[model samples]
Target: MDRSFEIQCPPFDLELSRWDTVFPHWGRSFPPSHARRIHCFSLGRNADKESLVGHLHVAFHHTVQRVPFLAGSIVPSLEGGNHQRKVVPQGVARLDIRDLSHKLSFDRLAEEGFSQHLLAEVLCSTEDNTPHVCLFEANFIDRGLLLVVSISHIVADGRGVTEMIKIFAQNLCKAQAGLIGYPLETTQEVYRSDRRRIVTGNGVPGPVEAHPALTSAAAGTHSRLADVGTCCRTYRIGADALVALKKAASSAANNSWISTNDAISAFIWRSIMVARHRAGFLDAGNEVHVAQPVDCRALLGLEEPYFGNAIYMTQGSLPFADLAGAATGLSAAARIIRAQIRTATAERFRDVVGCSERAEQEPHTRMKIADDVLAGGIILTSHFKFGLHQVDFGPAFEGRHVKALRFPVRGTMVGAVIVLPRLPDGSCEFMITEQGRTVECLVDDVFCRFTAETKTAKSVLPPSPTSPSRNGQAEFVFPESTSVKESTALNMTTLQAPHTGTIKIIEMNRPKAKNAISLQMLRQLHDEVERIHGENTTGGTRVLILASALDDVFCAGADLKQRSVMSDAQVEEFLALLRETTCKLAQLPIPTIAAVAGAALGGGLELALCCHLRVFSSTAVVGLPETKLGIIPGAGGTYRLPRIVGISHARDVILTGRRVEAQEAFAMGLCNRLVSHDSSGTERGRALQAAIELATDICGGAPLAVRAATGALSLASPAGEEAAYASLLHTTDRLEGLSSFGEKRAAVFVGE
Candidate 1:
C-alpha cells in the first residue's frame, strides 16, 4: 500500500482538558547502543559556550539510496494489469542525515519508514569529508531510499528507531481510526558552569556551563522565548517569479550577497505579521521572531549527520515600533535582518549551535539552555526535499513515499515553524500562517474586512511614507552644498507661501538617531504647507522642494526608534499628524519637488512621489523595503507606487521587499531626474534650482492654466495621471519615453 501524508496519533494527557502536553521524558543525552556511533558523535563537539552549534557544518548526503517501486505497487493503472489483490513489495525510503533536525522532521518516529539520504549528506566519505553522518539505503525500484533518521540517544534510546515507525504506524493506526496525533517534546537544557562534561585529550575541561548567550547575542534586543507555533497552508509558485525574488534580493543588498535561508526567513516572518494582523491583534505591539536552523558540521569539522538535535535557532525580530507607523518600514527592517543573517551563516556560529550538549553530557540531565527557545514564538526551517522524494518501500510491504511535516503536532504558536518542498520555480513554500481571515487581510486589503468586528488595540498607526527623506526621525546628511537649512522651528503650517510666485523649501530636521522621519515631522510638514497656502505676501507658492541634511543619509525613512516608545495617545497623535501631511501634499497649489542623494526609503519614497518632480543624484537610492519589518506601506505607497510604476512592478518590489540603486530608480521613473554628485550644489541643489525654473516657467502661463495642470496630476490613479501626462504626451521626447519603456531600451528624441 502507498503510504502518503496520512494522520498519526500517540498517547495524550486528558487531565487538563488542554492538549498542550509536555512530555518531559524525552532527554538530551542517549545511552549509546553502538560504540562507533558515540565515538563519531563525540569527535565534532564544539568548545564555545556562547556561539550556536554548527549543526549544518557537517555533511552526510553521500549515503542516499533511491528505491523505486513498480507503478503497480500503488495502483495497477501505471502498469498494464488487472486488479488482483496480490502482495507486492512495499517500497522503503531510508533517510540518513547528520542533522537531528532533518532526521526528526523526516524520521517516522512512531512507526516504520525513514530516509538515510540525510546521513550521506551529513557524513564524510573521504579525507575531504567531515565523516559524521551514517547512511543505510534500501532499493524499491527505480528509486532508492536513504535513511537519515536521528534521535539523541539521551531521549528515546534505540527505541527511538522503533518509535518513528511506531509513530507512523500509530498515526496510520489513528488515521485509520480517525484522529490527529499530539506532539512529543524534545528538550531544553539550561547553561550553568558547574555541571559540565569532560573529554580526554583536551587542554582544559569544558565548563559545566557558561552564562546563557542571551546578553551577548541579543545585546539590546530582547531574546524571545521559544514556543510551539502551528499553521497549515498549501501554495504553489512559478519559476520566473522565484528567480526574480532572489535576483532582487541580491541586487538590493549591499555587496549583493544573497542566500536562500535569509530570503525564506524574511518571507516567513512577514507572513506571520499578516496573520497577526488578521487575528484581531492588529494593534498589539510586540516583536515577531523566527527560529532558524544552523548546521554544525563546518564548525566541529564533522563529516556526517549526527543523531541528535544538532540545530540552533536564530531570531528574526522586527518590532512594532518599526512597522506600526508606515508599512514601508517593514522592508527596511527586513534588509537589516538579512544583513544580520548574512553574518551569522559562518562556521563559528555553527560550532556554537552544535555545542548544546557539552555542559550536560554527563548522560542524564535535561537540556537547560533551550528553555527560552521553548518559550519564544515562531520557527522557520527547511527539511531538504531532494532526499525525501527518493524514499522507497520494501517489496514485502507496499508503495510508500514521504514529504515533510512539522514538529509540535497540533501546534500552539504565536507564529508557527514551517518546512516546504523546493518548488519547480526555485522558490520555497512556507506554512507560516494557517488559513484565517486575519492572514488574508495582511496579504491583501480585500481581507481587511474580516476583522471589522475587532477593534485595533493601537489606533495611532503611522501613515505610510516611502521616501526616506520625508520620515527623517533623525538626521543623516547626503554630502551636498546648498542653501538648505534644517530647522526644528518649521512645524506644521510654517511653509504656506505669502506670495504665489515663491518656491518654499521645508526642511524636517530631528537629527540625532539617523534622520528618520517621525510623526512630529509629519505634523510640521503639514502645518507648513497650510502656512504657505494662507500667505498673502509670498502668496501661492508655485513650487515646493523637500530636502534633508548634508552629511551621510537623506532621511532614512520613518522614525521607528521613536515610535516604539509611544502610548496609545501618542501613537494616534503620530498617525493623525502623518495623515495631515499626505493630505496637504496632495492639495498643494503649485508643483512639488523631493530632492535626494542617499537613502530615500519607505516613507521617504512615498513623500517623493507626491511631488510633481522627484529629482535625485546618481549616489541616491530609493525603495519601499518595508514588508521585512512586518508591515505594508502605510501612507499612500501601496496606492502610489503601483499607480506610478504599474501594479506589476510595485508588487515585485513590495513583496520581495528589495531596494534599488539610483540608476534603477531613474529607469523605473521613481525619480524624475538623476543628477551628478558634487560639493558645488549637488543633485538636491539642482532640484531647488529646477523648482524655481518650473515656477518661473509656470508664472509665465495663465495662473488658471497652471492650477488646472497641477490639479489633475495629483490624482491617485493612472487613468487620471494618463490624462495629465497626455499634455506632455504631445512632446516628441514623451513619445520616445513611452516607446523606450515598452521596448526595454533607451529613448532618443529631439525637443519638440
Candidate 2:
C-alpha cells in the first residue's frame, strides 16, 4: 500500500546563512546530489498505521511552525546575486507513507542489510527535480517503522537535518502525551536573526579551487556510474575493539595521543588501500589521498542551534609503500591524517573567508574530484558525533528507538565512507559505498582478519614470538639490509667550463634514478652556477647549456622518496631553496638552454621552464603532474607557466596533469626546438649534442651586443621594467656593445 500527501506549512520567510549560498553552486554539476538520511526506528510492537500517519502529520506541522525553513521553498537571492539564496515558506511539505508488510518482512531487512527494494523506494533521482524536503515512511507489519528523509543538500547540511528531526520528534512525543503549549528552546525569529548576524559579519566563504586530482576523480566517478554498480555495507566495531584499536594506533605511533575517531579512520583508510591493492586498482608508486569533511561550526564560533553548511574539506596523502608497510605503519598514517585535520582551525576558517571575499572580484571555475582518477582514495563523512540515537521520538518508544542510520548510496559516490553513531551495544558502524570488488575484498579479507585478531583481549596478547612485542607495540623483523659502495655526492652534477669559450655546460650525472634531483644535487648546481657567475669577470659566457648525463631521462623530478621522510618544516626549507635557485638561474646575465632528453615532470619541468629556451628530444615528454599527488607545482610553475603559455593553456595542462610529448610541447610553444635521434642509430645524448650546436651558432654573434640585446628584450614588454633597469646604461657590457658596433671590425671582447 502507498499513500502521499502534503503537510501544510506555517507562513514565514527565512534568509539563508552565507554558508548555505555555496552549496547550490558547489553541486551545480551534479544536480541529483543531496543529503539522503535513512533513519530506522523500532516502534516496539507495531502501532496502528492510520494512527501513526495522523500523529506524524500533526508533529510535522507543529515542527514546521517552530522551524519554518523546513517547509520553505529555496528562492534565488533577490539581491541580484549579491548574497546567498533565500528560503521562503511554501506552506506545504511532501510526505509519502508506504506499507511493505505484505511484500517484505522487517526481519528480512535486518538479515539482508539494506535491501535494494527498500532502497529503491527511498532514494531520489535527479530527474525527480524535487527541491523541497521529502519525507518517506515504510511501515513493517508487527515489526517497526522506517523513516527516510531526503533533503536537498542546498537547503541544509547534516546538522540542519539533525536539528529538524529533534524538533519533530519532541513535538510528536508531546502530542502523543496530550500536552498543550510546549515551550520551544529556539524560534524562527531567533534563528533567522542569529544567522543574519553571522552572515553579515563573516560573509560567505567560496569554494576553494579544485585540485586536478579532485576534478579527475569526480569526473571519473560521475561517468562510470553505470558500469560500476554501487553498494553499501555496514561494518560494526565493538567498544572493546575500539579501545584495542586506539591502543594499537597509539602504540604504532610510539605513544602518541590518538583519538578514537582518528584511530578508526586510519584503520579504515589503510584497510581500503589494502583492498584496492588486492583488487589490482593500486600500484607500487601510486599514492592514496583521503579527503575528510570537517565540521567548522565550533571553529567559526557559531552557536549550536545555527543550521547551515559549516564544513571544510581537508585532505591528507601517503605513499603506498609507507602506508602498507609494517603493523606500526597505521600510526604514521594517523599522524598525517591528524595534521591535515588540524589545519581546520579558527584562524584557517577566517583566512578562508578572507580568500572568498577576495575571490569575488575574479571568479574561477570550481574544482571537483573525479572518481576514476582518485588513485585509490576515499572521502569520509562522519556523523559519529551527532548523537543520532539520542533523537527520541517519545517515552512510548524509549526502549525501542533508532537502531541504525544508513545514508543512501548514490552511484556517483563510489569510495565514499559514512561514519555513523554508536549502536545500543556501544559498537560503531561504518557504511562504505564503492564500486567493483573493493568492498567485497575489504569485507572478506581486511575486516575479517581484524575481527579475528581482535575477537578477545587474549587473542592479540603476548604478540607473536617470532616478531615479539615491545611495550604494547608489535615488533616485526625488517628485511635484510642491502649494502652498496658509497659514491661521492659531489659528482652528482658536473660543470664543464672551457678555458676560453662563450658557452658553459652543466650536466646532471645521477643516472641510476633517472637523474631525479636530490637536495644535494640542487645545492651543488646552485653553487656551481654562482661560482661561474663570479669567475666570468668579462661577462663573456653568452650562453649556458644545461643537459643530462643520463641516457634516457633529463630529470624525472624531485627525489620524492627522500622528501617523504622529511618533516613539514624541512619540506618548506627544501622548497624555498629550490625556488631561490630556479629564480637565480632565470635571472642570470647570460641566456640558458635546457636540453631535454626524456621525461621532465614536476620540479624537473619547472626547472626546464626557468631557462630562456628548451630543446626537446623526439622521445621527450614534459608536464607538471603534481596535482595528481594532491599538491600544486610549488616551485614557480603556477606563475611562470601562465606567463610563458597564456593563462588558458597553462590552466589546461596544470589542471589536468597530462603529459605533453615533444611534438605537442613544441606546437604549444613549450619547447624552442625538437631534435630527432641521430641517423647513426645513436639516441643517447643526441638532444645534448643538438643543444651544444645551437649554442655554438649563438656564440658566433658579438658577445656584448648579444648580452645587451637579451637584457633589453627582457625588459621591453612588461611595465616598470624600464625604471627597474634604469642603471643598465652605466654597465660596461652596454658601453662595450656601442663601441664595438662603431668600430665594426669584430672588436675584441675585453675582460672588462
lDDT of 2 by residue, 1-752 (tens): 46776655555546565546653354233323456667655554545667666666667667766766666676667663443467676645666777766655455555545443355563443333556754545444336566777666666677777877788788878767767333322233533443545643255444454322222122334455445555556666656666666666675326567687887788778777766665457786777777776778887778777666666666778887777765555777787777778877765555454443443453432224334323467777677778878777865452536756776555335667777876555556777766444554453342443432211221222122123356654332222110011112223232322323457777776654577777656766777677666655354466888877666777888888658756697688788889888888877767788989888889889989888888899989889999999999988999889888879889999999999889988888888888875675444477877887777766655454455556666667554355435645565645766788898855444433
After the best TM-score superposition of candidate 1, give how far the Cα of residue 646 lies from its true spot, in angstroms: 48
How does model 2 fare in lDDT?
Answer: 0.63
Worst 10 residues of 2 by lDDT: 478-487
lDDT of each: 0.41, 0.63
Q: How many backbone clashes does candidate 2 have?
A: 17
lDDT of 1 by residue, 1-752 (tens): 12121111111111110000001111111112111111011111222211111111111111111011110022122322121111123322222222233333222321121112223333333221212122221112111222323322221222223323333333333332324223322112221111011111123323323312211221111123222222234232233334433333343435646555454454445444544543444443655445454443344453332222223334555664453323333344346456545444334343332332232243222223233222223445454342333333212122333332222212123344444556332434444344233333233321121111111111321222122345543211211111111124231122323223555676544445355775435544776778766755223555677776544456677788657756677677776676667767867867777777677788877778677777777678778888999988777788878877788888888888888788887887777767766678666556545545554554554343455477675665768766765656466556666788899975543323
Q: Which stretches of candidate 2 lie over 4 Å from their true place?
A: 24-32, 44-46, 78-84, 114-118, 121-128, 134-142, 180-191, 194-196, 199-227, 251-254, 354-368, 371-374, 395-398, 451-752
Query: Number of clashing residue pairs in every model?
Result: 208, 17
